[model samples]
Target: MSDSNTTDFTNPSTFILLGIPGLERAHVWISIPFCTMYTIAILGNFTILFTVKTDLSLHGPMYYFLCMLAITDLVVSTSILPKMLAIYWFNSREIDFSACLTQMYFIHCFSVMESGIFVAMALDRYVAICDPLRHSTILTNSVVAKIGLAVMLRSSLLALPFPFLASQWPYCRTNIIPQQYCIHMAMVKLACTDTRASSYYGLFVVFCVIGLDVFFIAVSYTQILRAIFSLSTKDARLKTFGTCSSHLCAILAFYIPCLFSALTHRFGHNVPLHFHVLIANVYLLMPPMLNPIIYGVRTKQIRDRLLRLFTHKGT
Candidate 1:
């Protein structure tokens, strides 16, 4: 029903995210490995979730944080993996504008929430290790619940500006996004108008949120180390350190990649696309993939529960 000129002038309302352009010929080859990774990530995190939920022994603050982390991993992986698979397998890369926005919103929201949760977990560890007697009273169910709510609220509120800024930009005729997923920066770059305001605002938000979270986490861990060193008995120090080891590993894995990505985007924009894509994937996939394993290997109670469950199923 439209005229030829009108049709020619109007950009398509949807975008086909052809991932890593030249890699199209390798899609099938990459898909096999990618799909395998996705399955493992899902199953691994799901097992952690199930084990924690079913085992009453894990009802304390540590497992409570683990379960929340598993949920965040599930949400983050689900947000991007299915879409990536579809693009690689069926060549169905099309994503509507609204759907893209939704994906971007949730991805940022959950990521920020995860950062806050990590900080909370660090605090919980510090309290448990540095002040064991008061651990129970300090991180009670009501207190943790309140902290969880604050995490969700803060993440949602902080990430709200990104989508709002993105929505204001008019899309150009050339709308091919270069990555597998709907990243906010990529979307903003595709806009027809000048993006200085949005870019600066986003940079400010990223630094403020991630920077403060990391700072608090670092401070908490420093005090924990001091407390550990102060203990005269080697056994006491080892036990306390062991309890926090998994969380420390997970935190390092999650935050380093995120900080690197943010730094590259801010200061290393001149870097090659391949480097960018690699770091982005690390930011997107590494946390989800490593979270379950970190928790499983580090936490004895949850690990035992998972082993028993699997053993029973095998029989």
Candidate 2:
């Protein structure tokens, strides 16, 4: 190994995360809402998991996929948020290179998993609305299980190379990552080596997973709209629309900030660094907290179950 004393391209022993850069004086105030969101995300997602797992009436394929979504959101949120809170609260922003890489791996891995599950949920909605008679037969337990396994495998295998390729480069430069958590490009950009390949692969992964998923979702919704229009009664169409609004909100909450963040990062050179960092946190933090609440309040069955749980406790 090169001398640590030299300014050569040597890998860092530890990286200091500069959370929300110029907002150092306000980290205390910022932590209030972040802490609340984290707590709500944890508690809300657990409630969904528990409600779905224990309720016999929710044993359908739709609820099963919902449970899977809750699990994914839970894992992703847990992996990213606590560390962010630590940075905000205690100034605990130092992270080892290997540990940082590990965090990056899981963040990318679970993000892809979350996207895959979104596609799966879209497919479920498609089948249920477009082909009601076959929905049950098509999305049986075995089929859902098989699809879940494929989703997990695809994300895990594809995202495996991100951290590996990032770690391949030597990091002789300063070790201050200007974000709350270790992200793919942010960490990779610190290397004093060629990172064009990492950038290209990041885009490739985005297209392969989220791009493809969004296309299929659009097709599914097209068919769904046709199916809804074919119905004679307005009430039927309205009811059908209501069943899907929650998922639509969930999708927007997940993807809109993500797309915006990516765009600003690539092209918004004049954009403030604090804005970029805020958006990164929004996309990662908002979806997990919002999803469960969206489903719990919007879906009548889950709402009823939640009410029953609270009512029983009250009694």
Candidate 3:
């Protein structure tokens, strides 16, 4: 048992993050790829944001949602990468109690927000391809704004419980977290009090947010596919399906690792802790780094705008 005098029963003063427990010797080497991914994520997402903002032709509801996605990806990565890099590079592993909770909140909150944005983007594509004439009228600026607000509110409110639940628990156990960052379950595990409620509620929130979002996206894609198939010409069908390819890539990049991480966390009892931590980091980093690349390469208008910008800069 931890000595009462040293341990803060209410909540510890700080938590020590063991950056990839099994890979301690490789921390420096690991920091190299993490830093590269983070730099790419920052530059790529910012490019997306800048290109979307400056180009009026690209200011459709689709791009607006893309901007929202870029911002969400930025937050999701920024929330943890710096601290993680610090842990790896500088041996700065200690994070304040309140700050840890805040980081945990931001990571989970923005992850849910990203999923919601995927649903919004899927709906945008569905309307665009399935009902082209009404797409503009359906996803007006005001409506898009409202949707963005709704996503924010939904993610924020649902994730609010995480930090609150974590903060209230008594941490008489060790303050050392096995992962590079403070995850909800990682923090909860340190609490001496009953944690079943936290665990179950977390699963509930996952279902309510991510599960619902995935279902909606799947439905949207189903209708989209049907619409594509209904097109009489083979060329028309391919063309329409091509429009969704980038978004589909983005969705896969974000969700595949995300779901795997979630499942591993909840059920993969035999999975290595380091592997779980790596997956969690990849889930956060990969989408941010890849989304802009996928969109820039796949979307013509944004690609042209980016080319012109770079050409102008070169001249």
Candidate 4:
């Protein structure tokens, strides 16, 4: 009974969310940047979605995958930011325990889905460039739908265990989560129980989702480069590489900060807490903010349409 009492801080009614520990005095000021980021992400993603849906010329598999990406970005950004803003502006950080788990589930699910979309987009580029003749036949509307459904299922199933495992542990430590949002690792750390299972499972998911995605994306790009070099005409090579530039930039934007954040969380014990928090924020927020810009700048079709839309409206 004493041991039980000692270990079990079970069924915590609420948990406090620490927005930024070292910068609590400045959360009001920090919200300015956060608000700007949220605005850009929403507007950018919505524009992409609107452009893809309205433009019949963009009905190809590539754009179909891109539409899915835009939707995912919108859903992900919305899932994390509202309550976060509430914390910063209203000091409403005392979230119900159940609400935190729900947030974690969505955050994890959407992140995996986004990664899956990236892999799918890479494959789309590979076929479009490397096997242009068969691209249409291979990536029909039906196949694209299947890919979307499969990714959704994979992300949902894989992330389910995360919150389940978290809820199983009795929370003896402080119930304050040390991040802007309900991150899986941050929640897991507050549990007094042994975290070996959660750690290994998290690693397993990362390998299966992120590691495999990186490997396949790398292979697809390698084959694509080989195909481009083998092209007889410079014009043909330039066109093919140009088609891939937007996706490649988005990939770098999404992965680099994420890798750094993951490395810091695991190995950088001496790293400042604020630095870790900020890096994680970049990983969570930057890709959604930048992907639309990358696509708009690199893809002539998107840029031309956007410019024409604005020009027509101005007149």
Candidate 5:
């Protein structure tokens, strides 16, 4: 171990990741669930991608947005799970500085992309239910592509400063990160220099990305509700609402855990470190695992297609 008080102001070549910190004894046992969730996440997301790609019935704006969500989920989960599993299973906790920064970048970047996709999906739902006549024309292939490109650019640009800022700091402090992966704040806290700029910028990005996304989603849903309630028949309202059930489930699955993790990290001072670690892991893994199942169960078209697929394979 390098001396913590060394005079060197240069960044460390490698950082030690203490997976789950205080629960080191339970690392092996804990890895079982993480590994399971990761496997399920991978298979579930790929299934969504393949099912959408091959099915002509699903070739719509909504399904295209779903494909984007699945891809984002895959990237988000893949960015952190392998390294986290390694820490738990083999005790391989040393991460190269540049690799750590890259992991941090992907994890955060795709997460924002995921949030943006949810907002797009919400708007797609709003248009579908509220303006069924113009839905097809409004969210055309060109428009969808543009939205995708914009989301990618927004996420990439917003996330760039996290790693860039981290790289500039001199890590005279210990390079031991308490979490399983290199979180932005975790890495920033290791710097010997002041990190308020990074901290405030992080807050800015959170409110700018997540807060704005949430507001838009709420507005979209509000409009959707007004449209639904304006319908004359109860059956019509129920039918319309059922279409949005899957999306609502997905949004809750993502944002709830995400907010919990962030709040716990920033404000839950009384919370145990292991609990924080576990919630953080859950925040990353849960959405990827749940999204496909949520859609499969709630969406009649997808459910029917999946059933046909399984029955065909069984024959």
Candidate 6:
């Protein structure tokens, strides 16, 4: 259905996001905490980026992927959190149709990119562990750069259909999006016309991209575990698992809530609205907040280098 046929166009061009239920009425109270979180997330991710870029010792396949993950986190969080803050603090819930679409597009794009980055991280671990002899040769700087570019391209392409399909839908009188940000599923649900096609297409994209990415990550870790256990020395096994423990935690932190959110949206809508909103936000915001800290605390080289860099300026 064309926009001309579906939407009245004479109606409001912008929509109100109701946000979460109890919080909507208490926007003032919530804004302070939300803003603080946004600041910390941005600052933390930026520190990782800066630390990795300037410190020569930190420049390796692991840190390269860490930098990419930081960049992705920054972009993704910035896309959603600022607008959410504006809505809560200033009562600025009116988002233009085009702007809404743009927001939805980037949310999808960055999400896919993050998934790809996780897979890439897994691949790095796989090479470092399973193919130890050729780890450096296989994950050379040029190769890492190429993989990063390919991840970006793949994510962009995968998300292209969402906005294109969304643009064609005629958004009639129902313009109230319950969430703070323009979520793709919520937007499609708001459309007056049949949205089965778009919904199914989205599901397909999610399964194909997230599913394949998770599968590869699982396989990489499986092989990694095998290599770790095969080591004759118990200390060697501990050391190997130690190197991957942080990434494993990060992967769980990212994927668990994401899969829960997706599943709840698809099969568990009979579940409470607050349940969905809470899980969705957790999936979106928690990883960005946790990723840098995880890498900084768990990775010895990164931790030592970051400490040195921070202490050097003070001295």
Using lDDT, rank the candidates from best to worst: 5, 3, 4, 2, 6, 1
Give candidate 5's total backbone clashes. Answer: 0
Clashes (backbone N, CA, C under 3 Å), per candidate, total 0, 1, 0, 0, 0, 0
lDDT against true structure, model 5: 0.92
Alpha-carbon RMSD, candidate 6:
3.2
Query: Which tens-of-lDDT digit does each residue in 252-315 have in candidate 1?
Result: 9998999889889778968887578668877978888888888888888877898898899999
- Which candidate order results from sorting by TM-score in descending order? 3, 5, 2, 4, 6, 1
- lDDT tens per residue, model 2, 1-315: 757666654767788899999998999899898889989999999999899988999998778888888888888888878888889888999988888988898888988888888888888888989888998899999999999999999989988989999888888787889899999979776888888988888888876678898888888888989999998999999999888889889999988888888778777889999999998889888998999999999999999998998899999
State the lDDT of candidate 5 residue by residue for 171-238, as single tens digits: 87688899999889788768988999999998887777799999999999999999999999999999
Local lDDT at 275 for model 5: 92
Worst 10 residues of 4 by lDDT: 1-10
Candidate 1: 10-residue stretch with minimal lDDT: 3-12
For every model shown, what is its TM-score relative to the native structure? 0.93, 0.96, 0.97, 0.96, 0.97, 0.94
Q: How many angstroms is residue 292 displaced in model 6 relative to the true structure, after the best TM-score fit?
A: 0.3
Candidate 6 wrong stretches, greater than 4 Å: 1-12
Q: After superposition, how far is residue 92 of candidate 2 from its true place, in Å?
A: 1.3
Clash pairs of candidate 6?
Answer: none
- Expressed as tens digits, the lDDT of each residue in 1-315 for candidate 6 is 566657463344787787775557777776676676667779888988988888888889999999999999988889888888888777788899888888888988998999999999999999999998999999999999999999999989888888787778877758888888887898888787888988998898778779999999999998999999999999999999999999998899888988888889888958888668767887888898889888889999878878888798899
Candidate 1 regions exceeding 4 Å error are 1-12
Off by over 4 Å in 2: 1-9
What residue pairs clash in candidate 1, if any at all?
Answer: none
TM-score of 2: 0.96
- How far is 111's C-alpha from truth in model 5 (Å)? 0.7
The candidate, 1 or 6, that scores higher on lDDT is 6
Of the candidates numbered 5 and 6, which has the greater TM-score value? 5
